[model samples]
Target: MSSSSAPTSGTLTYDQAGVNYDLIDPLKVSAQRAAAATASHLASHGFTEVAASRGESAYVVDVGPFYIASIVECLGSKALVADEMATLTGRSWYDGIAQDTIAMAVNDLITVGATPLVVQAYWAAGGSDWFGDAQRAQSLVAGWKKACEVCNVAWGGGETPALAGIVEGGRIDLAASCTGLINPKERLSVGDRLQAGDAIVLLDSSGIHANGLSLARKLVERLPEGWLTEIDPVNHPGLTYGAALLAPTVLYSPVTEALWQAGIVPHYCANITGHGWRKLLRHPATLTYRIHTVPPVTPVLAFIQQHAQQDDREAYSTLNMGAGFALFMAPEDAQRTVEIAQGLGIGARIAGQVEAGPKQLLIEPLGIRFGDDDLQLR
Candidate 1:
């Protein structure tokens, strides 16, 4: 593994990398408020929007007998890493990037307790020449189909636009929209049932899982070999930084589906993405999430932490660390939730419980606390 000198002064931050939620979140809050105003318009179509789900991961609407949830999510800059990795390794990593795109959409969709039914892709290339590479194009298509099959959703077709000047040449932006069903009108989980005693079950993540990539990409500049820097010399002998970053995100829809099939309904579910552990405070309810344990950090993430010189608070606030998805449910169902996740070959554990207090998340092990001010998505 190549080595880089420690930062001369301040630690690197996500904001320094040009991804600042402080500036971005107020816009989301403003949009949500504006979006709520248009909900009443649904009445004309004989459907009622679930006002409570306005700020949830997926937007839900009641159409009499059943509820529908939908979300559109983008893959962010992770695809750029795959692009660089392809150049370094001489192998197309777009297949994993394709799955990462689908995972981003469906994971958010399932947090509303909706079973994903279909996914639509949006591939906007900088130029038509982008698709002239048959190998990369085919890998992307195959991966998208494979991910849809894994999530048990149909590939409902999509649009591929070639924007020459708008997007940088030789690059493509990937995103997807997922539509889901909340049948029987009982599976809707928008934190309405979240309370003091609900247990917090955390599922393990497969490395970074597509969040904080901008910062990760920025960190590459400090390294001598850049993307080719080996993440770890002993354990992961030949694993390049690019390979680790390109690891496909874990698709979590199956865990949600399996829990529902087993008759367990989480009070609230959060797909721990961009907000990192701070997402635990996403619910609107005024409650304290006390986490007793945290999943072990993925090796690649540890490498980033050491190189980036991020403290526990900074790291947990910006990246997933290890937990990918979180579930707040009845205390009695905590073990069952973990079992269900494990059954599906996902690592999970009862990490904490909710408490009646201020809106905050207290990670006990690291003595890290994220207050309501940390996240303002609502």
Candidate 2:
């Protein structure tokens, strides 16, 4: 029998699986170092790179009086989920995948306190025939445009490449990039204001928000019926496993813009996608994140945890579980931040606080502690 407990002899881990970060981490470091070396070239273009923005969610460039934030993010294999759903339910989940792609890009760009201005898409397919289906093509177009509208950004043109040999003939990879403007210059939240007494408010995610789908898809393989398996009726009734997983990601750009407009500036912000909750401490600081209360894990995530049989350490470190975006601000603004997010129709709460100490993430409720060693981005 499988159990979500300690790792025994047959336990599964992310490292043991195909997506090993150990191998990928070094490549990222090498690329970042190479990218940093070219910063001096931007100086001649009348743009200077922000000193500490090299490893941030978005790259910030100083343009005279204002700053610009830019990011490029892929939807990962989440689009594969959409493709599978199309075969099983005969309905394209590309619309949801479109929204996920936008969320993945804009959410990261906003972490630097920039308002997205222009967004572009990258749809790489194995063959041109992939877009031959009218329903899938139209759904992707409409969904991507709708998400851009929610972000209040212009839908700039994008590229659709047909690389028959590189990608599977039936599959397409979705990704996006956007540029944001940080007006007035004082609105930048790049960790300079992040201090010990600040509150950590976490915005909730709408179930598996486009991070660990590569792992989640593997979990489905171990299931009795794979994608066709029904989600727990009591928890997520009337949804197949693929449908529950394909639900559109929650858009957080509007929520952050609302908070900014309210005159509540966060000291730092992080889009909790790739690194899960540990992303709250992405900045290179010696402060500790004391999580007093952990948010309720979403039903879809709960299903993943139970079926995958992972312990808390593995699960929380690998999946967002519930928390999506994080904001570090003064204690006085914590409640109002939650209020602003909730007002924007997004769920949120004050989940933790920053403390003066060695860098670590202490989840008091779950008895889980992640040291700086556990979250090495550099």
Candidate 3:
């Protein structure tokens, strides 16, 4: 867990750690505008783009009888924590990284009311011998396939390229792409039915899933033992910081599938990832998202908050804060959604309801409000 890097400042910010959304957001906006222009190109191929899906988590295209949703997501820098852990613990955590890759992709795809059909992996290594470690390679493959099977998706073949100049030695970057199906079309939950009366159902997260690892890793440099530092003993027992952060992301596909089986189609579904709870305002409607509750913060995240000195606003705006997915549906389906999630061994509850105001998210418990300007995903 030791490194040559200097100890970081006591107080840290995500932008200071090198990922500045302000600089990166405009690029995303420009890319979206450019990609939107290419939508008409799909029409000639016997498919038409779902206009509302343009700025959504996944891309949905209609091909006459059925619709297909696609998403490509990376594991981000979380793999770096696993690399450090392997050095200290002598155990490879790539299996969890593999699961995180699948969770990142399919979670986005299911939000478009699509059932994941197949997933393709992308493993790019800096050195040719990155996969020479037989155990790590086998664990990655086993985890990826198991995640796909749990999501009821097939493991589509993928590519592994060794890029000399593109990547760094002893490091492997992980990402995946998933294609899903929305058959009969009525199950789509792209916010088309979202309205003021809809209730918001929130699902619990498995601590620090997939987002904010850059900031977390940077915080490691500030710690005395880096990743080896044991986190909150009460919450994590004897687990080190690296082990806690590497906990695999929870896959939300099964929850969505359960909703479909019970005929409870959410008006809109959001996979709470990089944008945090601000993603509740991701829909294009002019409605306001009024959240009456904030789920209990996980201790691992609490440790980060205390260590990083982030305020409620800063913490809620950046991390999942125990809430992972948000579902907007008619008020009658609110309790039912929670039941479905609980039946599937997931924690969930009716968090709030929508309002007729302008597009915004109001967290009543914390008195924090995020206007449309706050969430600029498009």
Candidate 4:
């Protein structure tokens, strides 16, 4: 057998790798317009007390000692995969995707140092498939309830739509809106407290943690039949490699609560979603996040690397690479942070440290450095 070579189409870009630029562009434009309109409205209404504001996937309203934050997220292409998985495993359709739907919203809030309070999901189903439809709706509610319970959040209820023509058999679109509260004094901001000598804490991820699936599916489609039939060599688990890839995303409430109790405020916290560590460097000044030690390579990630012919750097940049959350803290508080996370039964480790100038990420011993190209979003 011969080895496969990397795609030679000129430094494979993210959009070329299957991220839908056309679909995302309109949404981006609309978001910008909406943000401007909202700001104008607020100003016109004489709401001048608001301290700061920025718009992206969510909006934040500053109110005195605390800030009210909201996030909205939809079940991307993974909804189709979830349907397939459910049919294959004889599980409820919504059962597999509901947790991720909630996590997507709650985690976004957490990245801004907000504590999630209430979660609401909106779902639309179709056809006369009452059995599947009812099961999916019920499973979604149960899943959200379970997630909220674990996160110490409350279920604020939501809307369910039954559209016969708009949705097809076994088809559903799920989305969520979450509200959170954060003390302005305690809110973590980029570059405010982050500095050189600050240690980085990495919280272990359960699996892919709900990003990069479009590329993952493309790669899987090109693979030979029964590629994931065998058990993974690393972390030998009973499930097939593909099955393990479906592991649910890790919830951060426990870790956040632990840090809150320990009074170990992070200088910066990143959810490590879609863009990985790139999201962590959204600060003003030049900064470098040196990841020295990483969580042990899980079987799923190892399989992806080997099969996709991707290097460690590409894998880490594209996926969570085993760490779900990256927290920047003072060197003195590193041990305490790890202890608190561990005490809460969450896997935590010292992944790296911050440094001055040369705004680039370096992986020690390996001598691998990632620059703007590697971290930049297309």
Residue pair clashes in candidate 2: none
Per-residue lDDT tens digits of candidate 3, residues 1-378? 223343355567666667656778788888988999999999789789999998888999999888989989988988898898999998788889999999999989999899999999999998789989998898898888889878999998898999878888989889999998997699877878988999999999988999989878878877787788889877567888889999899999999998988988889999999868888888888998888977888777888888888887888888999998999999999998999999988899899999899888999999998898978776
Tens digit of lDDT per residue, candidate 2, span 200-294? 99999989999888767767767778887887887666777888898888889998889878998889998888767778769999999999977
Question: Cα RMSDs of all predictions?
Answer: 2.9, 3.2, 2.1, 4.3
What are the TM-scores, per candidate, against the unseen true structure?
Answer: 0.96, 0.96, 0.96, 0.86
Which segments of model 1 are wrong by more than 4 Å? 1-9, 21-26
lDDT of each: 0.90, 0.87, 0.87, 0.69
lDDT of 1 by residue, 1-378 (tens): 023333444688877777656777788878877888899899999989988888788999999889999999999999889888888888899999999999999999999889999999999999999999999999999999999989999999999999999978999999999999998689999878988999999999998998999888888888788998999989999898889988899999999898888999999999999879999999888899999999999888898888889999999998999899999999999998999899889999999999999989999999998999988775
How would you encode candidate 4's per-residue C-alpha lDDT over 1-378 as one tens digit per residue?
Answer: 013333532233344456666788788777766666666555664443232335323456655567677788876656766665666667664555788888888877776677889988777776546445566668867777888887888888887777788877667777889998776547644346789989999888877767876655555554554335544644474555456666767788678767877787787777778865565554444788788887876667666666666676677677777788888889888989898888877789998999986778887745667775554331
Give the Cα-based TM-score of candidate 3 against the true structure: 0.96
Off by over 4 Å in 2: 1-10
Clashes of each: 0, 0, 0, 0
> Candidate 3 lDDT (Cα, whole model)?
0.87
What is residue 363's positional error in candidate 4, in angstroms?
2.3
By lDDT, the better pick of 1 and 3 is 1
Q: What clash count does candidate 4 reach? A: 0
